[model samples]
Target: MSLDSISLEAIRKELLDKFKDEKITNIIQTKKYKIIMEVKPNNFLVLNGINKKRDTFYIHISIDPSSMEIYFSESKNTEETISSPFLNLLQNHLIGGKILDIKQPDFDRILHFIIQPYLKFGQTQNQILIIEFMGKHGNMILLKENTMIEGSIKLVDSNINRYREILPGKFYISPPSQNKLNPLNVNRKDFFNIFYSLKDKSLNLWKLIQNNFIGISLQNAKEMVLQANLSLEKDVSNASQADLEMLWTSFNRIINNIKNHIFQPTIFLDPLSEKIKAYSLINSIQFPPCHKRNFKDANSCLESLFTELEKEREILSIQNKLDQILSKNMLKINNKINDYQKKLEEVKNCEKYKINGELIKANLASIKRGDTEIKVINYYSPRQEDITIPLNHKLTALENARLYFKKYKKTKDSWEIILEQLNNNQLKLAQLAEFHKLYKQYSNSLPNLLKIYNDLMKLGLSKKIIVPLKKQEKKKNKLLPAKYISQDGWEIYVGKNNHQNDFLTFKLASGNDIWLHPKNIQGAHVIIKNRGNKQSPPLETLIQAANLAAYFSKAKKENKVLVDYTLKKYVKKPKNAKPGMAIYSQEKSLLIKINLPEIKNMISQNSQGKILSP
Candidate 1:
């Protein structure tokens, strides 16, 4: 969800307190979505309520259209990077500058960070980093005096948005306002006056508040109803005088908190599902099942939430790409198979040509020249019925017989060729079916899915999955798998890609180690390091590994999936087999339902949301 204006106000206050007068020592743009600013300490280094020992400041700008965030953070996950023009522009201007002020303009979800360069006395200049946390429209723009746009990470032209074009040397304008009432500025008198003047008394109180008020979200509107001890579903027009008074009092109480800076930033998480649900300034009393994590500052809250959100979005992006490639290939193969089937049916009648040839040759004496067709007694038939042999008018009877024989021979050859092509097409369709099955099972396992997709493209069996191509190097690269520590303290490894699967199953796993995979399903190969012992894993640990197999296979959506487990020694890679393909022997199978939420929660709580490299 986008941060509402009230939350932005809280963020503004937090950043202003934490970063005022600090010089930006360095700048790092780790990815398109994240930017890091290193700040030098402004005073003696005793960290407590606000200031910390850390020197880095983070601004995460998500490109997602539904939910976007640009908030202060202490750190972010380090990702591979390439040179970016926008990063260079930001570093040239923002580095070695002191943050002078941080403000949210008119309670909008835009943070204007004003800074002055640490230059010679005669050359000092002021600049602004305007972060718009407005979903798909969200962007980071460098400005001179907050109006003239010097540059932006993203360029908005007339084609993208006619309302405002953000470009170099152009005047930057605030997005058009909705003209809703600013909750902090509206007094109790004005608040009551709005409800009293409402022509629709039957409107729900929560809807009315959300529609008429700025900086108030649906959750906050519901909170207001709770504070007033009134049902959110209650009609505002039918409310009693006492109820209206209570509501107005509650509304003022919230507005007063915004005015007095009484912000209690909280991020609500569902522990079971392991999902970050919502955030608010005031402590939420609703959502009992959700784990409410109160933060010392909103920056920390936003950092953790948006970081996880970015990872989830990345996984979704990979899934979408896989879906597109698989769907495209599947549709193409299906059409080819249909056409081949029709050709096979048409050529199935090749025997009729041979029969005509036989009839023409047998009736050669009875048939005359210049005849289009001739009727004769059918000696080849079981009942000896009469038969009509079509004749070429210009050919002699023997020549016509030879022509029919040639036609029969040509169709017979075509029928054999078509049958071979049909067999090859069916084989390809089966391979694609396997790919689709694996894609559905392991869409969440991005690394493995990507590996499989690359393998398909390499074999010329699937369309190329478009990705940013990296410069090739003359080196032998190692593959990494998803690592998790089991509840029994044993290390478990699951392959992310086909290369990783081969590496895990053949190179990393010892003979005595345990191997697991979803039975008759396309999924990641899972291995449990057994310390070279020829013993079975604990039932719980075995189930845990099996769960991974199920969760990462085509059977992920099924109620119960069969998972096969055996000693690593029993798993064998065939010569010239496709990547990730292997055979196993002496395996035991378990039937278990996959609880993805529980599995994900386990991974997060145990592994700290990090997949280890092999």
Candidate 2:
């Protein structure tokens, strides 16, 4: 809903009324970087302006009883007391300047601060403070004696840039190619004409206001629309008689509601849920009336559920990434272990003759003298010049194999521990995947349950029947069963599902009442009481009852259907029978086509009593 011209006008009127009796007393900065002005009301502080052109322009203003100080990013480290150039200039002019009037350039667009006695410095006077905030674009302008002193601009000229100047010496100019709207010059008729030109109803009021005027948020536009009681779509130029009436009524109601309920928070709903809720309400008059669910609360629950699912998805993504890295590393480590084992085996298989040759080549005196039975020595060269040898009386190859086997055992032991950790991590990854699946199922089940309940309610069931279904239960059984009433006010029992069917035929129904069921089809078992009298059952009544059976049955779309009817006494529920499953004998079959509208009318009439209760 766009804020049309009419709504903007209303906002303009409101702002004018609010500030009519106020004056700017002090200016300060909010923690969020907004500029706030203290006015005469004393009870309220107006957010005077905002800095939008550059984030660097955020200046903190502190007000004390004795003096006011302004701090900017550049002055953070100065230990000596020094005034900000901008603050000093503003203070000198605005300290005692009496605000003569305040005007918005266009409704909530830009504010022109008109002050009398503009500060005189070296014969300069008539300084005015103009603050412009047009959403993405905003600036502050200072004018001394009608000539601009300095103003915020999108681009600084070379003269200003070279001199590092944003001061009173240079003249101020409006930004290039800026579309400015003067609100004071626009009248109601002009606004009406402009709004009427737009034909699209879906255009948001805030967006329209922002495009045509300036400086309006969606919240502010919505407030204006509420104040006007106006249909955001009603075009003044093309309104038909009916449209005019609707527009007028809506406008008046909205305005009155706003005036009565000032400062109340806005209520919003999910569109999808809202539509479903409406459908449920509309369809329930014909079917069993379902209980209404709070769509707002349901939407909130759904949002949280989705958010939790998203978080789980992110966690799963991280786990998968980690598992991939671990698997790659494990493969690399296993390959290294296998290669090292092969090298160790090669070392162990080294020939004893080669070792003996090395021992002879080293010329160890004991071996040469044959004093050690010509023992072979397994030797390792530490350097070209030195060799260390250990002689084994046994064959030299066996001794070398023993050393290689010892090294293999140590390396294998380390690898086994690493493999154990990998196996544990893989198990954890599988568990996480399972958890994600279960969470999704659980999240999905809630909406399905809600949909089923809503569908059932649209069938015209009373709250007495509907409320019990929402309760927690230990077993899958209905606390309250479905009951039907005959045209003569005789109570007839009908089963909703298999379990209820069993109960109705055996426990609830009388021996004399005729039982009804759609022949050879999945449907409710309906029993109509036989009022022992000469009067015959009206054809209409019989058809109505049959329609209920067919409507609730699998043969709902068949033009004609065979329904079995018999005494309740003939119907019997077997031991350990499932819901809606019952056996009966001595049944009479009647073929009749179902008339849904007539049955609905009958049910609706019967429900009047229940509806009037509260």
Candidate 3:
């Protein structure tokens, strides 16, 4: 909802109440696009309105407790309570006079503020004060009885006529315009008739007001619909009597609400902190509590908050890519390792290499005769000398041995490097897997937290909702669990992930705080605690928090899972560790598949509006 209509209506109602019986004293131009009128009751009603949605321009009305001061401006001057060029003119000329008449140019649709007042000059006779309010097409003129003293004009002279003709002893009239609407006589019924009769049947009430109604804003039109209890898009012609009656009731209700100063303002949520700090006079039904970063801090922070969420999503994308790359590299290294092992086995199984020792011993005698090249000529050596034959011309024995040794060395060295690389790849893949696991846990936890925040806000405790800051405390290794608490003393703490299961159990927890988590699958670490031993909570409360944790975690929808629980003092966060990672000892696990309907019922029965159920 826009605040413009609400503020304007409030000011207008106030003025109408104060000046119901008062007469205008005098009217004068305070400055360009500004005017002031003195009233008999000595009370000035300042009316401020902004035509643009931007905050730069504003219409202001100031009323003094004793002798009211009415001022209006669209300038961005924050120092003075009431300051405007129009107001300045009114103050100067209409301080102690009375209004004579008001005129409207039917052709130009221009409103003129005319006043006759006794002046201090000469004979103390009445002088005319003329001011026009018809946008840029209108002008203001001042006259002394029947004679014009001064006039505001677009041009001083032209090829056809001189502007001085309107300076003195001249009449004033508005210029011509093709389309116009008289604001003074416009009514709600006329608005309905005119808009309903238009060719565009899809036009809603707000659209009609924006396009056809003179001086009526879209915000005001929406407010009117809300007030009348009539759907803005409902066809007026087809509306039943009952609908019309309801519409009238709604309209009256809104009008009454405005008159009685009952307005709910729109709370501005901080995108960075996801907290609300300021409010405007606009009616908004819901407040989105959790906001993201990386958005422009304009009139609304929602856009920026979404941008932050998008960045997180992008991070998730990058993480997935990294995981894929690591997986592919690990697979490639494993394949190479397998190939090297096969090659090494083949070399070891080679007949020549395997029988080389026996062959050398048998040929020892032949080899010692200075016969560098020798070959066995018999199937079985009857005698070493008898089996000897000169070596053929293809290759020498020493050269063959050297070549085999060289091949063995190359294979060994290559295999070693491949094995080492494979081992390193496996380690890296493990680390990547761990990283992906933790990231998923963190991502899952965020939505649950946001849902909790929203639910809390609905209960009107939005101001109390806070984001947990990361903190580290070093002591005698005592456990400190995480949890959320309500104003009425209900508490819930979720763990970072499964790695923190032990920490959530052994440290950071008190004996009194209830522990809740998903049954078996890896999920958030949830702890519901009582700050003191005030009283033991009901079983339903524990179940509700547990169900939420399971729903938000990686667990698929199953009948039941096991959830372990212990005191916060039992759970401990390890040093130099990732978020949501913890250690816990001597913990008891509960096998409870999430019963969403039952848990919801229990939440409704126990906490109702006190705790956020969604």
Best by TM-score: 1
Q: What tens-digit string does per-residue lDDT give for candidate 3 at 1-614? A: 22233444433444444443345544443233333444554444444843333222122222212111222323333221335444444455556655444433341223334444446684554545543333333344555565455444332333535433443345643344435354334445764466446787565655554565444456655655655656667765556667655654554455455546666534456676544433334343233434422222122232222223433443454445434544655566567657756665655534343234344445555454344455554434355333333432454555444444555566567656756665765665565465445434343243333333333345443244432221111111122334444334576655544434455544555766666555455677776767667576666666556665776567747766667666555656689767566566667766667777764554455443222221
Off by over 4 Å in 1: 25-54, 62-65, 74-92, 132-143, 146-182, 185-204, 207-213, 252-264, 269-276, 291-296, 358-368, 374-386, 459-464, 468-504, 513-574, 578-614
Model 2 scores worst on lDDT over the 10 consecutive residues at: 275-284
- Best-to-worst order by TM-score is 1, 3, 2
How high is the lDDT of residue 517 in model 1?
Answer: 95
Weakest ten-residue segment in model 3 by summed lDDT: 468-477
Which candidate's lDDT is highest? 1
Weakest lDDT window of 10 consecutive positions for candidate 1: 468-477
